[model samples]
Target: MTNVSRWAAMLALLFATAAWGGLFHAGKLVLNNVDPFWFTVVRYTGASLLLCGILMLQGKVRWELLREHWRRLASLGLMGYGMFGILVFIGLSYSVPSHGAVIMATMPITTLLMRWVFERQRPQLWAWCVVALAIFGVSLVSGVWRSSTGAGHSTAFGDLIAFVGTVGWIMYTRGQASVSKLSVIEYTTFTAILALPGLFAFAVVATLLGYANRPDPADLIAAIPPILYIVVVGTVLAALAFNKGVRTLGAVHGIVFINLVPVSALLISAAKGSVPNGSEMIGTLLIIVALSIQARKMGLGAKAAK
Candidate 1:
């Protein structure tokens, strides 16, 4: 990539990471007043509708192509949107938002491992070390290594769930690699449509089971602003920007940039009075460094392969 092009790609990646980082704080803000499942239902439902409208406006709607990849699309939807979304919310409920963000810092490492294992394309030794460092860093960030018993057992459980969510996202990204032949809008729309019913079902179950508490009117009103931000900027705009960045930088390089998400979330959380202590900062730094190293290694490997 030329210097200018590379700089543009980096900027795009940074913006995309910031958008995703805001999701942790945004979701936390809404979760204070709304049920997690219901929040996802609303978020994904709105995103799906918005994408559908865009497709219609562009005259690019293709019902037949959706039918052709129905199974893969549904799997992606269920795992990526439905299961991953709901589980992360649950994990957040049990853990700190900053901790969840830090855990997510491991996504690039997880994606690399999955690609290596499933695709049989081994990464460099440094890449493996980076993954190990990220995993350790996540444990520290989650307070799993602070206990006299060697990280409180409950923290371990929460970390495990958060890590699972990270794995789910990595799988989703890998799946996207195979389906990149489709336009981003088309792929996003299909995933959203397939996930819609499940999201609604999850919301319904939460409400019926009394898991959803009614929010105060003020709280509901407060949530509206963040909801709008999430729907418009976080989901729609970020998706578009990420697709453009990937086109310019390629997937491995584009994805490595997501390491910035934890940093953004940490800063946002600190501003919101959820500051992490020195240990947490150290852990976050370790994870970011690990992910960066792993990403660079992967990017180089891709270039060598090409």
Candidate 2:
């Protein structure tokens, strides 16, 4: 890529990371008035419709390719959108948003391990050190080093669920690595379509069990802003931006920027009277540094592989 194009890609990646960061706070706000499953159903449904409309408008709809990859796409939808979304939301209910955000920063290390175990790819020693640092950082951020009472309610459980969700995300990314031909819009549309059934199933269960919270008119109105933000900016725009960044700067380069999400989430929360303690900040910094080193090493390995 040319310098200008690379710079633009980097900027897009940064914006995408920021949008993802804001999702922690936005999701927390939305959960105040909606159940996790219902929130996920609405968010994914809205995002699906918006992406479908955009694809139709751009004359880029490809039903044939989607059918060809239907199984993989469906699995991606179920794992990444359906299960991952619901787990993180439920996990957040038990943990601090900042804690969930920081714990998720370990995704890069998880991705590396997945590649090693499943794809038989060995990473460098530096990468292993980075992964160790990331684990320690997450432990610190989650207060796993401290007494149970020192942490908030169910914080440990929440962090564990978040770790599972991170693993699911890594699996989804690995699945997508096999999809070289699909356009971003095509892949997104397929996943969105596949997510609908899973989301609807959860929604139905919630309603049937009377677990669904009926939003008052004001609550309904309150959900509008965050819902729109998530559907439009968080899902569609961020997906496109990240894809573009990966195309220009590569996935490792783009994903290393995601370490910024925790910092951004912390800042947003602090601005809203949810400031993290000094330990959280230190742990966040350590994870960021570790992930950056890990990503750089991964990029070099990819070059060597090529």
Candidate 3:
């Protein structure tokens, strides 16, 4: 690839990862206004509806094409959005932001492993080492990174939940399996449409069980801006950018960018009045170094990352 295209691809991946970093904070913010399950319902439904509008503009939506891919779409949607969404928000509710952020950085490693196991596509040994370096840095940022799911022990339990969600996320990544015949927008939108009922069902159950409050207009209005930011930037745009990067740079390069997510999330968290702990600062620098080395390996000058 030309340097300009390479740089743009890297930047897109970075932007996508950065957007994901912000979601922890945003999810916490939105949860204050809407309960966990309802937040999922509202968020995905709005995203799906917006995707419908986008599809309409793209021309007559090819409803039939989706039928051929329905099973794959349904499985990915449920695993990726529906189940993973619940785990992450609930995980964050139990853990501190740092725990969630640090745990998320491990996703690249998990994705890499899945790529190897499922696709039988092993990366270079040096690539594995570089990922390990990033993962070690993430563990430092994790600040007592046990993954026990004992609900009473909040941070550890949260780490465990986040870890489980990462596995579900791994399936989502690997189970894309073959080259998609669908365009990016078509793939993202239709899967989301299929995923809606489960989210609504959870919302209903949560409301009925008194675990969630009924969502009123005022509550939705309070959460609208952040919710919109999430559905647009965090979910849709990020997915597009992420897929672009993966296509451009291949999965190994694209996935390692995830190591930087905790640093981005930590910095964003600090902006929200959560001051950085010392380990976070050190871990951030280590991760940057790791990314810089990896970038150089990709023939992007280390200085270019500046």
Q: Go through the candidates in order and give each one's C-alpha lDDT.
A: 0.77, 0.78, 0.75
| Candidate 2 residue lDDT tens string, 110-166 | 777776887798877888889888888888787776667633423678888877876
**Which residue pairs overlap in candidate 1's backbone?**
144-151
* Regions of model 3 farther than 4 Å from truth: 1-5, 119-139, 145-154, 177-179, 205-216, 284-306
Q: What is the Å distance of residue 218 in model 2 from its true position?
A: 6.0
List TM-scores for all candidates, in order. Answer: 0.86, 0.89, 0.81
Which 10-residue span in candidate 3 carries the lowest summed lDDT? 145-154
Q: Against the true structure, whose TM-score is highest?
A: 2
182-259, model 3: which lDDT tens digit per residue?
A: 766787788789888877887788888888777899999999888989889888888778777777776656777877
| Highest lDDT against the true fold, candidate | 2
Candidate 1 yields a Cα-based lDDT of: 0.77
Instruction: List runs of model 1 lying over 4 Å from the truth.
Output: 1-9, 148-155, 205-222
RMSD of each candidate relative to the true structure: 3.2, 2.5, 4.8
